[model samples]
Target: MTTPLLGCDFSSAPTRRKPIVLALGTADRGRVRLERLEKLESLAAFAAWLAEPRPWVGGFDFPFGLPRELVEHLGWPTQWRECMRHYAGLTRPQIRETFAAYCDARPPGGKFAHRRFDKLAGSSPSMKWVNPPVAYMLHAGVPLLLEAGVHLPGLHAGDPARVALEAYPGLLARECIAQRSYKADDKARQTPERLIARKDILHALEQGSTRLGLRLKLTHAQHEALVHDASGDSLDAVLCLMQAAWAAQHGAPSYGLPADLDPLEGWIVSA
Candidate 1:
């Protein structure tokens, strides 16, 4: 059976307002075909999905680690497992308090805690809002991935049939739009211009405009559905779709990934 390529738009606290949405697709001869798969309403439902047997490679849009600097400064364990253990032990309020204290000491523009990976990868600071709102994502997403027991390639070693990679749609979107704002959940900013820009970006990806040399093919209705969703949920899922395409194309080893992710440092798809 051909392995499926998966892309997930994750939420730390999945609810009616912020459900976990996954995009499922496959690649053929360097082209990707994407469609929405399932919208999970609760973490329990999402956990069940992860446990089901499947052979797939996925690009999930969530921070997998923190900046190494933040990890070290907080005196937290550096190894992925250990850091997660420490984090998991703390209550949400405790975590917020700890991180808040760190933020208090740092000046604005450096408030949110950061990891070394943030600097090295040129990724968004885990605390930034405007660019990706990843800080909230990190707080909300990583713990669940760990709990789900999904094998995170390059960070943790486990099942090969299910491979997880830290993915950023922005990494791929910027390739096509280059700093153009294509989405704003705030209705006030969801102008026709932004809507048109999103459509154009989708078209460019469909036509294989990126360095990955992969075109995303979608039905006219699929295209419209993605555009109509004002929350950027569909767009984020598509961005993940591209990342999954890239990972599958690169031939990431089946299961059994490396097990040395820095908790404060995030991971990236191997080049």
Candidate 2:
């Protein structure tokens, strides 16, 4: 049987206007087909979705763990689950204050402590609290994945059938578009150029031209929907879906993760 795959574009705080988007699909051979898109307007909804009993391998666009240097420096727990649990107990303001202090102690151009995988993936430091607020994303999302009993490879052991891998869409996006901004959260900045960039990305995926070597099979309407959604939430979800497909193709235990992947600082799939 072809295992179902999910690519999630997450939000720490989701509402009707900017909900979490999940691209649902499956992979066979080297082809990934877009089965549908699901939106959750709240974390509770997302949690419920995760709790569903099914077999799936998901590529999640959120940091699954923090940098070991930052964690150790902060005197936090070193074990992956213990560290995350300790992190989950803190308020957002407390997290912000603590992380801010850590940054303040560092010199210019070297503020944020990063996971080793961050350098390879070109991802924002998981400790970042502003701009993208990926720190909060790790706090809000990872605990839910843990509570949902999903397996997070190279991090914590859980259900084998329901696997989750850390994923960054920008890694794939940069390969196709090379630093072109293809998305804008602010409606005023959603330019025609960005739309064209999105089109180009979709074209590249459909042709199986990206380094992951997976073809994206999207319906005409799905292609149009992804291109027109200026926020790029749907497109990001699809990007993650393709990554999940790639991971699934590898099959079983590691699911394309590096043998040396840090248990406390989970690696991104295909990074």
Candidate 3:
């Protein structure tokens, strides 16, 4: 049986404007070959996809958990399962209100609490987006991952075939560009320079100029398709693809699942 490779651009509310795009590929001799891209616009569609059985590995661009401190501070359950149950039960307004109150009590920088993962892995809260825009991504992505029942490597082991790892495009981008801005959804900042920078970044990845030792070989058409997407959606998805590629290289069962992920502390990328 051929193992299908998957990369996802997830959204909390996956609609036409913000759908979950899954890229399927295969690995051969350490190279990942792109085969297809699938987009699901609703939770129902995604649920169907998740229910299917397949030997696959995927990198999903979303946070798996919030800081343990944040959960504890709110008097919420510290265990991942209980926390997710409690969080899923609350309305969006209630979640925002609770988080907002936490922020109000703490100083500006101390708003979102941190965890051991934050310090070790160097990631922000899933709710923080100003600096990296990941806050919006977390808000848009995590819930759906939960609903789909995909196995979150360190947090929850839902499915063995359907493996999910937390991946950040910036981690790959910075490796090639070193602090250069590549994309901006904001029209004002989508300057020619930024576009060119994005192109260059894409080119670098295509040439395998990173630590993963894997080159992202895209056709000219595919290159154009990735470069022209100003919102960075396609690019971000491909970034995840590379992470999946790296995970595949390790010959491990799954990329980020540790032998022992804390049932209460939750999982982050095992960087």
RMSD of 3: 2.8
Candidate 3: clashing pairs of residues:
11-140, 12-140, 128-135
lDDT of predicted model 3:
0.70
Q: Which pairs clash in model 2?
A: none
What lDDT would each prediction earn against the true structure? 0.74, 0.95, 0.70
Candidate with maximal TM-score? 2
RMSD of 2: 0.6
| TM-score, ranked from best to worst | 2, 1, 3
lDDT of 1: 0.74
TM-score list, all predictions: 0.87, 0.99, 0.86
Residue range 1-271, candidate 2, lDDT tens digits:
9999999999999999999999999888899999999999999999999999999999999999999999999999999999999999999999999999999999999999999978789899999998899999999999999999999888889999999999999999998999999999999999999999999999999999999999999899999999999999999999999999999988788999999988999899999
Please tell me which model should have the higher TM-score, number 1 or number 2.
2
- The numbered model that scores best in lDDT is 2
Q: Which stretch of 10 consecutive residues in model 1 shows the poorest summed lDDT?
A: 254-263
lDDT of 1 by residue, 214-263 (tens): 89989888889888877777788778877777877766553322245443
Cα miss at 229, model 1 (Å)?
A: 1.2
